[model samples]
Target: MTFDRQDLSNETLLHLYQHLLRPRLIEEKMLILLRQGKVSKWFSGIGQEAISVGSTLALEADEYILPLHRNLGVFTGREVPLGRLFAQWQGKRTGFTKGRDRSFHFGTNEHHIVGMISHLGPQLAVAGGIALADLLDKKPKVTLTYSGDGGASEGDFHEALNVAAVWQLPVIFMIENNGYGLSTPSNEQFRFKSFVDKGPAYGMEAVQVDGNNVLEVYTTVKRLAEDLRENPRPVLVEALTFRMRGHEEASGTKYVPQSLMEEWAAKDPVENYEKWLLAEGILTETARHSIRETIKAAIEAGLQEADAVPMPTADIQEEIADMYQPFEAPVTDAPAGSAAPDKRFIDAISEGLKQSMERYPDLVLMGQDIADYGGVFKITEGFVAAFGKSRVRNTPLCESAIVGIGLGLSIKKKKSMVEMQFADFVTCGFNQIVNNLAKSHYRWGQNADVVIRMPTGAGSAAGPFHSQSNEAWFTHVPGLKVVYPSNPHDAKGLLCAAFEDPNPVLYFEHKMLYRSMSGPVPAAYYTTPIGQAALAAEGDELSIITYGMGVRWALEVCQDLGVSADVLDLRTLLPWDQEAVRRTVEKNGRVLILHEDTMTGGIGGEIAAWIGENCFEHLDAPVRRVASLDTAIPFAPPLEAAFLPQQRLREQVQALRNY
Candidate 1:
């Protein structure tokens, strides 16, 4: 409670108290709307309002705030209109999310707030990335991230905090320890004496505050915020509070002990703070009463306005379609077909990344062991010295957090590229990639312009852990674009194309083809069109549609058989060359879609289905597909090769050609 007395004017004190009560009043209004059948569901932070309000008050206007579903106070304090909050719940287009989401899930870049999704742990790393970006840009700012006790248990939580601590990021990790995580009590949730103690383990300053005491929480955060701005380092704050209500209104407090609830109720944050303010002569009773009355009036009017706001008509489609709008490239193709020397696939990709970074100073490359050691594959060799450690960062082995931080950096107008050590490990950060990074733009009109370089496909006997082709996982997500290039030229071109695109993209560079494949690649800056397929070979008998390693295999098979078959290399998988396939099938009348991933749910299946639907009449035969066996990638060379279906692809193609 050491904040300057001069700074603690009557207006400031009154505002603090009002902030503590605002969320509760809003919750009550939302409940009334729900009862009136105006809205659907809500997740209110009844007892956690004090920490939400106080923590937010410590932040400056320029800093970022990443709040979970319960941090309504943080949103309202950041000047998010309560009417918009109601509109989101009511699915009205006037809401911040434009009726795309229901719940406290919208954010505005102008407000310096990125609202949390259902999985709250990822936001911690995202906030840390923002803080890291601010430090790099020499901006005097800090990011504050919030999570509940339950969210703290997630691996993302640990990874994010560890990165923040290691980098000494100007980020504050605040855990609202609400005694219980849903129905699970603290005693059953963890073995630690207190959540604050965990911070020191990660080299962060740890403090446990009386979360119910608004003044204590505010002062603690203010001091930490000031120190962070001066000497940037992450801090951990555990605000010990109680749920007061169940996880949601429908759940009720049946699980919470009545005795415990009553005991905590006696220490109501608002009532106690109001009493202290009145006694200290900081807040007059009349003024305090007026503040409450004004807030109540606002809540009533805001709810009404939200209810009347109509659902968006055609706006969402317009926005989704706008994603396809092309950005004017800073540099175009080499003057009219200037020939460049051939480069290795690995070298081509590295060169392409280097060229893109040079063109856009804000372009960043981040991953594990990517600095001094270069990378597991050396794809970013000498990148640290060339781009500086700030741009070519060596992140900890926190997969999800790395992607999450990349997301944060991406939204701040910095072009970020994340190197997933291997495609298999991307699963660690699946929640962030699929939920936040992918959908952030569609949900809140914020650009998560991130390119994740996934060194994928198996042939090195590197085992299941290191080798995987998980492009289909991303292709399935609505907001993500998937790219899997087969050769040196396409690897360089498609990767650069991903950087230019203003949405999240998964760039799968086949490890099997990295050193093995070599072809002509332009030295000049250029982007191969994203949705187009490359016609590697042409003929009249059959069509072989494939991507990545499969394209090379298809070429070898068609040539060895001496069959007059057309070969199409689908360089970009998600926005796969649908038109190219249609044309090829129409001409050849027989087609085979192939890939390296497992058969049951591979991208080949999607292509096969599309062909079945779109070009059924043109088929001289059934559209065939070839993929790896439906199981974990075996470790043995013989087993792995057999599992992958590489050797047998030629036979399958031969049989189809003969038929």
Candidate 2:
């Protein structure tokens, strides 16, 4: 928070001024393009340039950065060409993303500037993960992420912060308090007056500074970046800056009172810094005018070149398309009907992890409590001894960092198998999952080959925060492969298959079924085909389509009621077993879809609707759906029992009788 003006060489000062000036000109030109409807949209960082530029220049070449939309300063400082930036805005082929990505969706593997995500909190974890990679590689580098005050209120922000602090991650969290998120000011969204105060609560040192002053931003960030290599811990820099423009182009300044704009404009960071430079004889009015004109001309030429460029052809677009060779059916000793005695679901997972790691030396297992603690449910016991700590390593309690590091390693051609303590906790790394891992392949034509194991589903009475089936949140994304395993065979087989798949796969394991279910699994290294379903049981009455814990519960209810039920386990949700569901419904007289997720917008509903529209003629009854209520998972045992699917098989029997 302390600021003492240190003398800088003229060359360094000029370089700083030039970096800030270029992005400002580009912003102004983008606004003009915005008004003309030439560019899609523009996010202007007029007053926040100093922070972005200053922080960026403080780091070395190999350090990682995840910038928010208003980080043109970072891009400029990194020497990302103005022509490339304009091409992206114009949706031209010359754009870094080859016209597939939008203007703000730019990234470079060589530059180490990871793409910016539209979501708020994911970058916190991703940056932490990058730092984790550096620590593992024995490299001297830090990861920095930028977010606005509004984004700080998200669950991911707090979750990532807590994890980073607990693990003492080498990360610098930069909160650019730009006064407002759209129309809502920071005060309206948060109870605390300043975000820096929350850093200590997460066990980190925080500094507040005048973001408008270039020297102040540069010096503070430089000091923190250096401290990271020695006494490594997460740092929070809450930069008090103002937004000179609205949230985006077309979002006018009409929402703000004229007096307020005038007041802030009088202390504009660009002008304030310029005045300071001139007063100190570091810069002259002529020099400032020349800098502005030079940048303006450069932006003009860049825009002209971008407009003339062609759109990316489809061939160029798919060059980096994710491709994975699906696993062939394995020859096993257990025949169909060679059923084994029931066992705990966690036992299957432990076996699965063991089998996968043994099969593929590249498959590494990591997460909090997953090693010595054997996971929250004893799913990874004796893994460290079996595979050694290098492979089955226990990470610091930083979820975002864990996932983010997985991403960095995956991009470096290393296979990573990560575990989230619980499904609900995955929200901490949502940004990394959604923004970086999910879109990396499609965005830059390279796959982030990573596997994330989420122990999900309810009925454990672990309460709302601990137990929840939120897999559908990820199934909706295009590039992510989502798998929910219901039994021992599928848990091991699907995970093995996921390791082979090129895209990022979210393997959702049921916590309730961990100890209550068991089945025959192949002892050898084997993998099942990704996106394929299994017909667990065959019957004449109805087809029960389900996955995870629902598969086990449905089968149990069928046996107890002595009903002839056909059950289909949809092992993968994204590339769902649509064909299998249709063929099964065609053979069975009725169709029943069941899941443990919330009723509204759950995967079961989507499947049922697809069946109703596609196979309505084959059914003897309407597709029946049984799902949890549209509410957070409850803590009380009885209430949770009522919330999750418990009687779907009986319901199917009753429906058959009615039919």
Candidate 3:
């Protein structure tokens, strides 16, 4: 069946034709450059240009689009500056990612586009985040995201769809069924007749369209988006098409049957669209030649500009810069009065979150059972009532999708704090935390202004799944900030500080300390500077460096042994107080680093190595470390106690003092 072009104006027809033809020409040229070794790799959308161009043009300028690697038409359709796009493909410094990322892996906020990662399904959840932000603000904005048939099989796909459906978010999940996922045919991917059949399980509307007909794709998306603005909800669109080229230039199409390729070739969107445009008298031979020549000239100019751009250098100073946005703590005066009441560690954290919500109107809290249920620990018990359900939200058990949603909120200039009921479960969302949140600022200047509250540490007899000191895991990652506080005062202050910081901060709270630990907490809000260690006690003979529950053990051991020692609380582990460490090592001439994580890969080893490398001359004795045994926490009380560093810490400190 032919597309009806009678309603569309002549100018709109020409513009749509140009958008469809531009990506085709560019891809053809890039393939040539790839063969000549000028380009590293290329993913050609040769036969499926209509899906990208039509869907992109259907949205308003203010709306966001998350495009996949092969969606060159989306970039060109959005007018993303051909020169910069070409520069990005060439790995030149002038690109949107400053050459940090290759191809379309980087997003450009100026054009309202969030680029795709190699893990294609995660972006769907991120799109949900952006949609959620718009819903909260009551904006009539919609987000459109793309995925291939193969990507639909990923767990994140189902998670994202389920969350969007439950929340009634305004997002369009566009799946381009290109018949082949790399070399495997679509028959091998799933048993469903079509992607639309799976949408009913998600409780969302779904539709199928002729991907080769640009008009159908455009009209379908345009109509759906208009409806979504008035009534926010998720919808799935399956665009049936074919991949005319290999997944990448390196991977040939030898696996594709020639008969199937020929069948799809007859349905080429670009060629078919041009023929219809000509037959309808919207374009003459002269105009078509003129259009082709103009596009050719533009492609040459962009390539020339990109070729002139220089490559990035291996300068260490430049490489380290822009990893994180500079954050300055607001100066808050200490609350006065000896009458201030003592509070539990959990109460202090709750107070900080409450204060932050009051401070930042756009702050959002999300976690499993956080809203009505008040979370597993009751930290957000009254938050839903105070802040309302919009700000204090309950999330599904899908950690990866929730984390990606937090990132999406951050992308839209909203602040979010996600609570993990237990620290050990973070493994489920490790990719989003380490790869997306940690690298966003360094790779593309996008600050993931997120705070992840981790209920960490042992002694609760919660077994291996619920109890684990996992701060060391995040400290090893470059783009994250790790903070652990020992008492109520620091807990409140540091939690407030983490909320204010622009980078992603992992705030670790000891489960045992929630009720077992209590101290004086001021009523007013304040921020304890991250990366600053507090001097818990002062003595010149020996220094005990630790944080969290370890600080309590160190102080108790020092008092019990009658040893005059300097006890230091290293609040933030990522940017640990190196200067303070140096001063203590130089004065005491001995050091003992204590932690609750396993001894082998704990932060203690890193601190000891740094001291030995930088302060070896001043040391009277070798630096020592005391940590938990390299085994999982057991359910029994005795086994759990033995697995911790309580007794071991005492012996290590005494041994260091004697030495």
Top candidate, metric TM-score: 3
Q: Give the TM-score of candidate 2.
A: 0.81
* Per-model TM-score versus the true fold: 0.96, 0.81, 0.98
Worst 10 residues of 2 by lDDT: 320-329
lDDT of 3 by residue, 376-467 (tens): 99999999889999999999888888899998999899999999988888898888899889888877788899999999988878898888
Candidate RMSDs in Å, in order, are 2.1, 5.0, 1.3
Runs in model 1 lying further than 4 Å from the true structure: 1-7, 312-316, 319-331, 337-339
TM for candidate 1 is 0.96
Q: What residue runs in model 2 are displaced by over 4 Å at the alpha carbon?
A: 1-8, 93-103, 178-201, 249-294, 310-344, 355-368, 384-450, 456-474, 539-543, 549-566, 586-590, 594-602, 616-648, 654-659
- Candidate 2 lDDT tens digits, 1-659: 23246776778877887886777778877777788888888888988898998899888877888898888888888887778878877778788767777856767767778766677666677676667666656677788888899988776687678767766778999999988988897668888878878888888999998898787888889899998988778999999888888888668677787888887787666767677678878889899889888888888887778878877667733553433222344543344455455445666667667876776776667788777777777778888778877677787666676776677666545678888888898887777788778777767655777899998877778899888899999988878889998888778778777877767899998876777766776555566677789988888777789888887778888888777878899999988988898889899868778888888999888888888788888878777788888998889998988887786447656776478
In the predicted model 2, the residue pairs found to clash are 122-431, 125-400, 129-401, 129-405, 343-518, 344-514, 344-515, 345-514, 345-515, 346-514
Error of 3 at 358 (Å): 0.2
lDDT string for model 1 (1-659, tens) is 22233467777777898888888888877778777777677676877788889989978877889988788888888878877777777888888777777786767888888888887788898897788789889987889989888889989999999989888898888899987778888888888989878987998889999888877788889989998899999999999888777787788889887899998888777777877887888888898788889999999888778767777777666776644333554454655677788899999999899999998898888888988899988988888888898888888899999888888887677889889888899889899889988788778788788898888889899888988878888888877888888888888888888888888888988887888878988878788878789898999999989888888888888788788888899888777888998999999999988888889888888889999999999999988888899889889999998999777688788778877
lDDT of each: 0.84, 0.78, 0.91
The worst-scoring run of ten residues by lDDT in candidate 3 lies at 332-341
